[model samples]
Target chain A: MFDMEPEVLERFTWYMREQSALTIMFHTKVAEQMGLSATDEKCLDLAMRADGPLTAGRIAELSGLSTGAVTGVIDRLERAGFVRRVRDPHDRRKVLVEVTAGDLAKFAHLFEKAQQSLVQVLSRFDPDEIEVIERYLQLQIETFRKAVINT
Target chain B: MFDMEPEVLERFTWYMREQSALTIMFHTKVAEQMGLSATDEKCLDLAMRADGPLTAGRIAELSGLSTGAVTGVIDRLERAGFVRRVRDPHDRRKVLVEVTAGDLAKFAHLFEKAQQSLVQVLSRFDPDEIEVIERYLQLQIETFRKAVINT
Candidate 1:
């Protein structure tokens, strides 16, 4: 690691905290608009972010909810038409949760707005600066994900 | 605004989405550690991030919860000692939610760990790179906040 100034660290910390707060608020708003409870929406997000459909047990582990609670969440999500549970193709005995493409299409506009904001922000920097910013983002995401998982 | 390559935009979009998901998971873990529901913890976070104490009405607006629901959140936060309801000093008739310093001290270690993660990430860049990264973060936060508020 390189040497860092204390004030630099302090300012970066403030940025991280502010971003966290904003992210939480944005999710709350998105959940509200989707007509799903925040918990249920968050669960669906977990499934959507995964590379493949996730088992209920895996979701419970990732979300820090009890297995029983996750079951109820999955049930509610299915009832809301936001997600569906299906038997895993490779593992016949396993059940997996998947986000419904048809239902999610309704919210494409909301997601598009978010993407536009990112584009607007990135447009401020030149290609080289964007590369540096991208490097920082990759490192920040990797480091923070490890920290969150270990927490 | 400047022209941007499509792939660059796509990569940055993925970073934003990943970061958002991680932030939500981090908040969920922190809330679980504090023994509060995610919604209640989120409301408390809004109060903590504000420049001053927030009235129940403001919390309701910011959190996208009804005033009645915000009342319940404040009650739970108060009972759990994460926050307290106090009469506004300037307007004794108006009640405000205040994050209790003494209670928050218990989570100092957790916040400190997050700060350390930021430091680890920042240390990878030299001062000039750090400045650029900081600029990116500042703009990203401001633009994203506006988008969240409007949404």
Candidate 2:
């Protein structure tokens, strides 16, 4: 339904592909630093980002990993002190995976550096430009998620 | 060196994190469809993105996988028809990993869908806003890469 000039479309595609590669590399580094395998680190990220603790099944769904694989990830994460298994208070029979707060604080410097880089990038744009950028990010994320799900 | 309101920074951080998570999931699904492990696919990606064929040592460096691990990844990818090893023309004793182009073309629909999503996102903005977004993406990629490497 939307039309873009071929060259412009090609440039944007390159940017998206570059961003994707860099993101994967960033996660690999983060996972290495946390002493967790990439899969385990990704599962922990799912738990950390959730509004509350997640069941192993929920993490499996979010990470696109098998339930059995998620169980192993949780086991390793628990041993690494990055997460813990707790009975869901709202449902006593349900086990939930919760990220351990204090331990992740040790990795603050890494995330802070990322935040600082973001601040630097944002600073170059005025309020109006920043607004446009924000809108673009929101739309891009929404559209890309739909594309990925359909894939 | 730059200042941003706490809330704006927080929002941007959330976007970055969400994008990162989605990218990982996309890679996982793509790998599953290609019958390769996530790590092998990542290595193959490194080879594919290079300007020319890469030696196994180069792939190992770029992917953060050990040399031995990269060897296994190459072996698997070769068997799966995603990549092949060839003697470097400049030095016959050296082996290089090269992506097999025809096979990846079979997955064009997935990538084309992703490209279409980008087109849709960009079509919402005027030319000036598109320029701002492009600059933002370039800086974000550069700064994020530095952050990732330093991490």
Candidate 3:
């Protein structure tokens, strides 16, 4: 017997696309407000999401962007004063990229607004449903990573 | 009583951000594969997703892009042979945009491949789990639409 129904798969794909579209719209709005390009916003986002200062290679890997592409992103971000490149003490050849405090402060309100909006939108779901969705998203992310590896 | 737990809300926000990252990656991959920019791939995708020739205003509205941005995207797509603009016979002030047959064929294969990959990834869930996820996503999309309207 099939583990999953066909309609389920269909809906999942539909949801993914719809979610993708919403995200694009949100980012465009935020970027326009910040006077930043989409890519520049992404670079800043990646830097902010990092646990600590990250190398360009690591950012590229996490972002599924090419190393060369990440280099350009870093260059642009650094030039915009959103991020800085600090030489790694342990590895002379490695440059750690960090999001500036100013950038974080600048985007703080936008992030807060987005969070509030999302929280309101999701206020209808119960804990169990939210758990299921979270698990499904985790699986989706893992699956994407595996696909990239296999490819 | 609150329907959502705090953790659930936090997870939902994280999921949204993760979904956003994945979309940017997917768009970048598609663009690179077609030797196009992200905007170009989006223009093609928008054209393909449309039921028929769409006006510039309609495309901009549906794409969550500004009219000027849509015009630029159309120019790039036209130059790349992916789309053409047809002036509305009844309304000279309006132009209708359509995907070229070659572009349609190309995007058909691409869409199929993406669907297959997504379906494979979703194959891990049981039937009930899949339905739950789908229902949850449907609700989320509806909620997002409401939020956008309210905003």
Q: Which candidate tops lDDT? A: 1
The parts of candidate 1 lying over 4 Å away from their true place are A89-91
User: In candidate 2, what are the lDDT values of residues A1-151, reduced to their tens digit?
Assistant: 3456789888888888888899998888888888888888888888989998888788888877788898788889888898889988888877799888999999887688888899889999888888899999999889988989877
Model 1 whole-model lDDT (C-alpha atoms): 0.87
Which pairs clash in model 1? none
| TM-score, first chain, each model | 0.92, 0.92, 0.75
In candidate 3 the C-alpha lDDT for residue A14 amounts to 69
Task: Summarize candidate 3's per-residue lDDT along A38-133 as a digit string, tens digits.
Answer: 777877787777788888888887667789988888888888788899999999899899778875586667667667666765665566756666
DockQ of each: 0.77, 0.70, 0.46
Ranking by DockQ: 1, 2, 3
Give all TM-scores, in the order shown: 0.92, 0.94, 0.81
Q: How much is A60 displaced in model 3, in angstroms? A: 5.7
Better of 1 and 3 by TM-score: 1
- Model 3: how far residue A32 lies from native, Å: 2.2
The weakest ten consecutive residues by lDDT in model 3 chain A span A142-151
- Cα DockQ of the candidate 1 complex: 0.77
